[model samples]
Target chain A: MQPTDLTPHAEPELIVFRDVSVHFPVFNASTRSFRKRVIQVATGGIVAPDHTGHIVVQALTNLNFGIRSGERVALFGHNGAGKTTLLGALSRIYAPTSGSAEISGAVGSLINISLGTDPESTGRENIFLRAAILGLGRDFIQKNLEEIIEFSELGDFIDLPVRTYSSGMQLRLAFAVSTMLRPEILVMDEWLSVGDKNFQSKAAARLDAMLRDTKILVLATHSRDLALRHCNRALWLEHGRIKLDGPVKDVAAAYFGK
Target chain B: MLENLKAAMADIARSRHYASLIHILGWQDMRHRYRRSFLGPFWLVASTAALVATICLILGPMFGLPPEQYVPYVAAGMIVWGLIVSMCTDSCQAFISQSTMIRQTAAPLFTYVARVAWRNTLLFAHNLVIFPVALWISGAHSNMNALLAVPGFLLVLANLAWIGLVLAILSARYRDLPKTIDSVIPVLMFMTPIMWKPEMMPLRIGVKILQFNPFYWMIDLVRVPMMGGIPPGKVWVGAAVVALVGWVVALILFARTRERIVYWL
Candidate 1:
């Protein structure tokens, strides 16, 4: 793909993945010992080398993609079609097995928003932990603590352990803390659908403001309407390959078969 | 190579940002361990006290050693061993416990190991309150040289850091490592000089075997300071070597295979 098509603006390319592939090796549970299994593989034993066991499953195959500064791109794909893997590659959560993925700007991922939050920690404490996991410095979180608490709308619950909060409350707290700090490259994997109707609109406006300041926004979602509303460009991934890549409207139509 | 070490040190120095995160996690872990219980962290002290009492009662008489002498000895050994074993067991689960974080976030992988180490250190600190009590009860001799235990404690912390790094990375890649450590720690406990004094062992066979066991060296290092004695220079040198080698090997492994750890998980 050309640089213009991939990274449209004059802003520098923040993330680039050339011929990236992610493969997971399946292992047999019944194998008596690791050495014996290796020996069996070395010998001419008729051990079934299925993808389910003792074989490799290619999750992403020779994928080529790039995200430029100040651009919001939506990665649309079915389940197990490498959408999350591609987003993970940009965040450096999952390194590409064979190809190079170079990301210049700082990246913040909203995938698994509560991944770093401790169940026994207060919501206020979890904010700091989650912020650090998102690469925000401690001083920054300390400075923005009040704003995060206000945005989360968890007044009294802020001091309670996140485990005490309901799922919606937990999501609000996590999202509020995550968005408190601006990142050069912001990544989201279906974490935006956390708030209620009114809160969703508020969150959407906040996200729009963030997108304006964010150098690059990579979101992986199943929602075509949301992608069209927020993302300037769209990528359609099918079977671990980018089937189509272009303007949001055209890609959404193709993806939805409109 | 020196530049890399400098860079690593710089990274570690700036790690306070990461430490704040670990502080939260460590606090959460400690809280979670005793959330349903009323006693909380005191449970660790109580358990250590009970074990010391039992071992002192049984092993002291069986070995023809006085309770006054063996009580402090076993107490010191058990408390230090508790710290070591806790480090070992917790390090094995370090990466596995934070698999979600590794899979989802772009933060440094070492943060999880630090969380485990910090949590165990907190527990060890709580358990250490018993040391003075045991000393008072047994009337063990106190000396200026015994203050060297502070450095000994730091050495134990450093050893835990190395072990945490190695085990976290290994267990992340190999799912069986937790189980392996579970079985290995019991065997290691027996091999270490926790229950029996090293002098009790016959010189030719048992003493030679204990000499080769690194855990024995570590136990002697910790136990010596509490007993108002100096650890041998050889033990100090050997500990330094083990810490250096363990850190170096762990660093190499982490640099080479850190990227794959998330995928493996």
Candidate 2:
């Protein structure tokens, strides 16, 4: 992957993964139990030759990719095709068990927008809680508090405990707080279609503005239309390996059947 | 091995940058527990005060020590003991409770441990209020020596911080460790001289066991100072050694398991 495809950006690459692989060692009830482990030690039993005896799931294997500045990439795959795992690795949640993934920018993940929102805390309080969880400093949250509240259209309801709010209202509050993140690299599991139709348009507009500022976007989704519309590049992952990587229209056509 | 250790140390150092984040999360945890109650966190203060009063009223006479002598001792012990027990038990769930956040966000692992440590510190402060009340009730005068508790309490916190981190990481992987910890802590309470004075025990077995019980030294580090006595030089040495060694062990364990913790969850 060359850095010549996109705009004349100063940075060569925003995200790079060279032969990155993530293997989860699945510790089931038997393996995770302390007593059983102790018995295995005491009796010198079930000492399988090596780590091969353990159950390990290869979520991602030998993924080689680079996302440059001013590029919007979509990860397409089947349900267990490692799309989410790739995004997780990009957002720094899962450390690659082998090879390397170097991400040099602040990663804003919309994977779970209401990640730190508490049911008992007030809407305003949840705003601070969620933003802090996103690693935003207090001054940033404080300065943009009003604009966020205004965008969510929460108005007087911002002071109420989130539990008292309807599900849509709650989503609005969470959506507002999530959009406040000004990360250099933005990650989304799926396009966050939040709230009712009227609110959706407003959210789309806000997301568009945010995307304009974001230097890189890595989205994992099943929506072909959304991918073709918003993304310039697409990676088709099959069974934890990249099946194809190219421009969105060509990859989408190939993966989704011509 | 060395690289993992460096990463673990880096996580510890970087968690300091999230102090405000941890502070708010910890405060939110405390508030969530007592939000509906009228007394709020004072409920902790009230319950601790009642426990101290009960021990002074009943166990004081049962142990054959006058309230003037016993009240302050038991109060200090109870207060410090509460900190230790809760820090231990709560830390077992530190990562477990925040599994959702840990799997979703890349915040430092030590940030969650610090949250547990900070919340327990807040509870310990509430419990500290009982010491002065006990002193007033017993008419026991604490001299300038009581100021030693400031440093002593910091030492105790430092030690508990590593212990909490180790438990958090281990229990996150080994699901049964928390249950084992829960059962072991009550037994430890009886073994340690919390409710009764060390003088009540038979010297040969009791003193030797107490010498080895790290909890005894940990409690004495704060309990003795709170009651206006300087802990023996040996006690300081023991607590400091435990703190240093415990952190080394915790760092290594955390480094080895840090990346896999998300998988375990």
Candidate 3:
């Protein structure tokens, strides 16, 4: 599928949430245990019941929205407000338990920068693992291996185990690897800042370039300054429901209480 | 129902598209597992050799067979049996081990299942080195019939892949299933003809019961050929049928659970 263009024309909606809701069934030790379940069935006790013993946490509730190409959307919410769940649904990690989540663009997620890095593997090996998990091809990874190493500035330490690296260095590697892909839709839990002040600037510059190039950006964050600066549109989610969807200025004032 | 089946097939196809990822993950899993050990994956070879030696030494006289005859028989059976058992037990961990990856990425579910298959296949390759040595020690000649083990082994792997996928999905939801699989595997090993020959069981019922165990047919497909003999036509038919039927069941389970698997994890 061809990527929807950024140049303004007839804009294609890259993401559509049609009455989407994600409900997670809370399965505790007792509920998840097969032996207990079998015994329950054998005893004819709770077997024929409604099977509603397990509680369900409604993470996203009947969400309705659409994101057009070139729209930069920021998700604003307090804790337990479903910002991350909305991003998860967009990343295709959490399929909607009800309704549909239709994403029509290639998605790159910076939700967890070290999502696929194995600490036991060396820095060089982790580059491959993390990139592959981001859906980058082997050819792309191989060609840019040196560039990534140089960008992350690991140099000689790239050959050492990632577990050996300090936390700052690991984040540098993860941030570098994550930003390598040019996805049409970029999804982030929040803005990523890596390493010391020097590397943080470098990481910020890299992220800016990625944001500039992406056709659509959906970031879930609580920072008001970041929402105003980077996002054109805002979605204020409250208790798994969208409280407001409009210009960043208006939503930020309402949600952040300007 | 048909739509679910189509989606399941699509998931399987996507797994093939991510073959490179599977290969890299599988290789990394094996390497990561033995990184600190000096012998590395060769330890797999060493352990297989030790197990075969222990079993042959103890069971040879009881089965009333000479060292040369019984050693190769037990060796072939154990090699195939090791692959079968490890694949079954490891399948339970296939999804659970990749819980983080499954929750974070859009990678196909079978990619994890195939990773387990690929890693065990590599270990199986290590165990295979013992088979030739076993034959030489038992004073058996290498023959052309051994080449037939390739096709037979492929069939066995196909059956194993589906079984592994099914288990991966089921165990992802039921946390207790893996523990149950752990205990059941040892019992299955003894029930299958790994250490004992079918001839050693004098009871006609016992021999007839072996026919009912699909593990026997799976082992026979690879083991019989490695022993320089063709498996019975029925063995070929049985293994193929099991592969086909198991996959149908596996696909149905996979399709139904593909979306819910991440939540279970």
Candidate 4:
């Protein structure tokens, strides 16, 4: 691992993880009791390395990779193969337990776009609130407010609480707000296929614009077609380690058993 | 230990990084709760004032203080305690309640605690309307000592953050811990000097216990100033000591456990 890869210093063109790994300590639920923990410790039981008897699950172990600026990297693997965790690692949601991950831009994780919307708030309010949760400032949201509302196509319904909107309408409003601004790095769980056919294209267009303006993209998906269509590079993760990393056609062919 | 402290301080440095998000979310919380109501959060003030009136009437004679003196004391006590007690219990779920935010974004964890503390601060402000009116009616002087409550309130807020941080982490890990603390808080309420003053307690037991009850220092720091006098040295020293020790523990715990919080959630 290059020293530059581990440090989050001014490497503007790089998103690097030098031997990054994340381990989750599962505190045994039964021993979580005050008395049980006390009794366990008093008896000199070897509870484990953490001294609390937690069974550690290694989610991502010894992952070494780097995605440069202007590269859209698609992650491919089986479910629970750590594709999502790898994307999460890039998005800054999970700090690496060993080694280090250095992401060099404003990161937007579109894994759950509606994570910020309040059901009780109107569509317009939800748009502002949702964008703010993505770390957009107020002036920017206000400047782009009309464009977001128009893009959602819920003109009159924009004033009503989101709970009143159908789930499709809610998703559209949230998606519009989330993708309105271009982030330096965009991590997506999937292509975010939502809404009716007409709205889906609008969403795709917005996503395309976001992708065009984004400096780095790390997307996780099961669709070989989507990967081939949007990404230039592919990385296949198996049990949290990269099994393959190369150009899209090569890696996807290897991953999909060509 | 020094390295851990530095790490914790660095994590907190992100507080400014997400200051805007915290502010917007905090105000949004208050708005969410009061959105459709006609009376809005004035109902909080109305209800708090009514409780003060009722308690002052019933307990005034029991403590042998006149209505004027007792009303201001209990009112300030009630208002501050409402904020303190609720903030403590609420902190247990600060992370639990925002599990979505925790899982989805890697913003500093302090923002969630700030959100809880700030919302309670807003409510405390709303409940604060009764303090001045109570003081006016009771004819308490507005003196330089009253200005000291500003620092007192700041210390109270500092205490809330650390305590909330520790409780949030522990409870997030052990789901049952919040429940245990939840039930115990109400019992501790009766134990604290909120409904009645320390002077009202029987001398020997009261003085010794009041000196020890950390919660009493929290209330006394605010309650004493509203009646227009400096708090005794013990209140200032006791409250400051608790704040210092509590933050030292909270910061250390946060640095060691901060990364694990996402997994626990």
- Provide C-alpha RMSD values for all models, in order: 3.9, 2.6, 2.7, 4.2
How does chain B score by TM in each prediction? Answer: 0.92, 0.97, 0.97, 0.94
CAPRI classification of candidate 3: medium
In order, the Cα lDDT scores of the candidates are 0.79, 0.88, 0.88, 0.83
DockQ by candidate, in order:
0.50, 0.74, 0.70, 0.46
In candidate 2, how many Å is residue B74 off?
0.7
lDDT of 1 by residue, A1-258 (tens): 566754466666778889999887655564423445557779858666563255677888888877777678988889989888888888877778899888897777777777766777789888887877776778888888998898888999999988899999998888887777577888888737667897887787777777777888888988887888778998888888889998888999998889
- Residue-level lDDT of model 4, residues A1-258, one tens digit each, is 776664433335568899999877777877566667667779988666666566878888899888777688999999988877777788888888899898888888888888877888788878777876787777888898899889888989999989999988888888888887678899999889888888888789888988888888888989999999999899999988889998999999998978
> Model 4 chain A — which ten-residue stretch has the worst lDDT?
A5-14
What lDDT score is found at residue B65 in candidate 1?
88
TM-score of 3: 0.94
Tens digits of per-residue lDDT, candidate 2, A113-177, equal: 87887889889988888888887888988999989899888889899989899988888888888
lDDT of 2 by residue, B112-215 (tens): 99999999899888888888888898998788888999888899999999999999988988899999999998899999988987778867777777788888
Best of the two (1, 2) by lDDT? 2
The total of clashing pairs for model 1 equals 1
User: Where's the lowest-lDDT run of ten residues in candidate 3 chain A?
Assistant: A1-10
Among incorrect, acceptable, medium and high, the docking class of model 4 is acceptable
List, residue by residue over B1-265, the lDDT tens digit for candidate 4.
6775786787678766667777778778888777888878887888899988888788788878877778888888999988987798889999999998888876778778888888889989999899989888777655778888888899888888899999999888777878888788888878898777666666777778667877788888887887787889877887888889999899989988887788888
List residue ranges in candidate 4 displaced over 4 A. A1-13, A41-46, A49-53, A194-202, B1-4, B31-43, B132-147
Q: Locate the minimum summed-lDDT window of 10 residues in model 2 chain B.
A: B197-206
Score candidate 2 by TM-score against the native.
0.94
Model 1 lDDT, residue A39, Cα: 70
